[model samples]
Target chain A: MSEAVSALNGQSFVGIVKIEEAGPQGMITLRGDAGAAALQKAARDVAGVDMPGIRGIAAAGDRAIAWMSPDEWLILLPHAQAHEGVATLRTALAGTHHLAENVSDARALFRVTGEPARLREVLAKLAPADLHPDRFGTGEMRRTRLAQVPAAIWLDSAGEARVICFRSVASYVFDLLSVAAAPGSEVGFFDA
Target chain B: MLILECPCCGVLADETELAPGGEAHLKRFGPGASDDEFEGYLFMRENPRGVHFERWRHVNGCGKWFHAARDTSTLEVFGTYPAQTTEPPRDIRDRISARRPGWTWREFA
Candidate 1:
């Protein structure tokens, strides 16, 4: 068992390790009934776009990205745009077979921008989502279990990737990543 | 262990998640209906020796109830779709329609 330690800030905790990997500037999760055609139509009408298909991700302008599912989806956006994006989706899906629950604060986002292969190796340890090019290619998204946590994962066209895990387990997953990175010794946190 | 496939959730789910809807193509008889209608409704069996359609619920998985067409003899799954969706791949729609004339083929096709 690892010894419990306190950080420089004097916060004592168990298994709360610092993540040296890049971190997302922002992220959000949206859950609801994706099968409702009326809700989908409303979302398109309000967001001026339709949600992406399963194993796919679509960006709504420069502000948000909506990932699809059989009965739910997660919408990711910049921190600054989170509130407005949720508001728009809510108003659009009103009075329909839909329920959009905001879970931005519930999840912690991690951004990986350097050493793609190394980052992939670290992620493979805890992610059940297929990260293969054929399956998850650039701009694709998947909702899968990671480190026993439900997560949404996606990669931008630029090859930068983002992974979101529930806040409750973020510290544990961060520790796991830190250990995985120890082998390659390329761990570092993002400035942003 | 009868391997049942679910429409909403793909194959490979526990049978416990499903509640047997009994041999597919059930006919219902009302008070004004005839004796033949009641008998057919109570105990009629195509006893399809080959392929048959079975309704199943993906309770433990997607929780969406749906139907599947499969071969009882060979256990070859034809296809599956959402409940009330008019598109099942195999010709089970024709078989179901042929057995009951008044039944709406469009309803469960």
Candidate 2:
């Protein structure tokens, strides 16, 4: 069996904000009522983590769950265990009004980390979300559009941000980020 | 260029991310209803110049349908609420009344 490579294949651009692929990680789309005890227990049983609350994230070791909506979440795990994780969730959530699907292959993710202000500058050029640390701080996830492409973005505890978009737009997103993160493209600011 | 807030996910979605669902609070007059009632429900629209309630779906954000109250002419948004209700919330109506004093849209004065 051939191993799958990252969407960007370790592509990196060292700039004011470091732009690089976040490696091959598991991405699962989970939909269920997080408030339901049965669903919470089932999620823990399958992903070894609790369901994240509204706009919140719950992490345990290598696994992390990001709240996508009221009844939806995105679970990230080790890439190799993605399929098994989906199967496990399906079996555990059977007969419930819930859906658990593996989207690891369908989506590509990029990590942007550096000074919070500079990082937000690059993202502000594409995404419309207010990236102020006070409003969108650690552990908050939002599914929005980036340069007209759908993306799910979340900030981690370490202040690094993961921006995930469809595989088809991975290259476009990467290229956009590269230019946005360039040293001199700072909007409204020029060399004195 | 309109920005609508989704009550479910609490995301302030831009016009590109949201799909307009047209006039809200419609009374469905289906099968066995009078011709006038059916016509009123299907063809008639209360497109007032001010204080109009509308339905919007956050297609790119949370994929949840919501409601927004705005003035058609001025484009001043009163507020946004969940789509589960049949009519505009009282607070939204009061907000509109306070801004456009004596302006009546549908039912509220």
Identify the candidate with maximal TM-score: 2
Give the DockQ of candidate 1.
0.07
Every candidate's DockQ is 0.07, 0.72
Give the winner by lDDT.
Answer: 2
Write candidate 1's Cα lDDT for A35-97 as tens digits.
777767755654455777655667766444455346655665554555676677677767765
Tens digits of lDDT, candidate 2, A37-147? 777887777667777678887788889888887888888899998899989888877887888888998989899987666777788778877766667777778888888
Q: Flag clash pairs in model 2.
A: none
Q: B1-109 in candidate 2: lDDT tens per residue?
A: 6777789988777788788999998989999999999999999999687778899988878888899998888777899998889988888888887898888766656
**Model 1: residue B5 alpha-carbon error in angstroms:** 11
- TM-score (C-alpha) between model 2 and the true structure: 0.90
Kindly report which residue stretches of model 2 are placed more than 4 angstroms away from their true locations once superposed: A157-159, A187-192, B34-36, B107-109
